[model samples]
Target: MSAQRPPLPPFTEETARQKVQLAEDAWNTRDPQRVALAYTEDSEWRNRDVFLRGRDEIVAFLTDKWRRELGYRLRKELWAWTGDRIAVRFEYEYHDTAGRWFRAYGNENWEFDANGLMRKRYASINDLAITADERRVAR
Candidate 1:
């Protein structure tokens, strides 16, 4: 059996918020392995245009993402939830290795298994270039 991540499904406002916060905290760590653990072993993901299945792809994607998106910082808010699904709106700031900053805004729909590990995630994101002074997320 898979380890249960707490605050399992059928979410309340508070628990849903907790779940979102947990995800945000994990992403902030930029540890792809740790972040991938929150998903089911066979998790499916649609991040922007890229399609990913399972932890290995997730880890590889994140590793390459962080490598290019230096100084990454993110914030996520719980948009809504029902049963085993959650909707989230998020924004994140990161600079390229060339030192140009950008902020990405997106919404994500997530479905979790009974163990509270995300089984599927769909995200739509857009990036906007911004000056360093325009940055909102602190390093």
Candidate 2:
């Protein structure tokens, strides 16, 4: 049996909120391995324009992402949920190595398996260049 990361199917509002918070916390840690653990071994993801399959691809993608997107901090909110799926709206801020800061806003739709590991994640994101003073998310 696969490991279960709780707040599993048929989500209530509170559980859905909890799941979103958990994901937010994990992402803020900037640990690619830890974050990838939340998804299934065969998970499918569409992040921005990149398409990925399986944990290996997920890890590689995130590793490169965090390398370029320094000082990454993320916030995720539960937008809606039903059955084994949830929708989330999120924002994150990061600075590049050259010190240009950007804020990314996106929506993600997630589907989980019986064990509570995300099997599918589809994210649509847009990034805006911002001055440091324009940042609202405190690191």
Candidate 3:
């Protein structure tokens, strides 16, 4: 069963939701280059325990991550936001080199520029579950 995405506040909710959807859509594409385009040239971000500064670093980081994580699927939910900052919690499942599977849980704090481009991103994530039958590629 698919869970409905939670609704946002007023005008800001749509904005927040869109930003999240954009991120999820980018992940669904599984293309690091395309996902990097959503951020600013000097965007600041941190994923899992790694810190990434600027678009180039972000691209490099994502590229390396995708290379190691096979059958990677990610989902993000907007937690709360006021103004240009939004907090999101996410879950990701992937398989490693030995075909071992793992699930990760994480929270992200995002800051967007006036143009809706992400400028700052801070994420905190950890493993949650490992399964064998999971069929969803990315939802």
Candidate 4:
């Protein structure tokens, strides 16, 4: 059975920010199963250019991502929210196995079910190469 995530829909600014922080905290853990639990079982996602369906696919994608994005740290801020949907702007820093660092900036639009489980997510992202000395996120 899955966890019943709360603060469901029709959000106030405070609640929306809380939701965004919750998502950021989960992603920072980099635990695929834990992260996948936030989404619906049949969730749909458009992550950059990849399209994914369902929790199994979400888990696989996140597994591949965290594998390549070593030392990942993320920050997400709530931009807007109404009804069961939210918009977020975020930045994350990670290094490749070669130790080359990058800062990725992105915006995501998420739609949730009544139970607060995200059913759809669309993200647009851009990555900039940065020197270790330029890194902003703590390891």
Error of 4 at 107 (Å): 0.2
Q: Each model's TM-score, in the order given?
A: 0.98, 0.99, 0.85, 0.96
Instruction: Name the weakest run of 10 consecutive residues (lDDT summed) in model 3.
Output: 1-10
- How would you encode candidate 1's per-residue C-alpha lDDT over 4-64 as one tens digit per residue? 9988988889999999999999999999999999999999999999999999999999999
Candidate 2: which stretches are off by over 4 Å? Answer: none
Q: List the residue pairs that clash in candidate 3.
A: 103-128
Instruction: Evaluate all candidate structures by whole-model CA lDDT and list the values in order.
Output: 0.96, 0.95, 0.78, 0.93
Model 4 shows how many backbone clashes?
0
Candidate 3 TM-score, C-alpha based: 0.85
Number of the predicted model whose lDDT against the real structure is largest: 1
80-136, model 3: which lDDT tens digit per residue? 988778999988888889888888788999877666677799989887556667535
Candidates ranked by lDDT: 1, 2, 4, 3
lDDT of 4 by residue, 41-110 (tens): 9999999999999999999999999999999999998999998999999999999999999999999999
lDDT winner between candidates 1 and 2: 1
Q: Rank the candidates by TM-score, best first.
A: 2, 1, 4, 3
**Which consecutive 10 residues in model 4 have the weakest lDDT in total?**
1-10
What is the C-alpha RMSD, rounded to one decimal, of candidate 2?
0.5
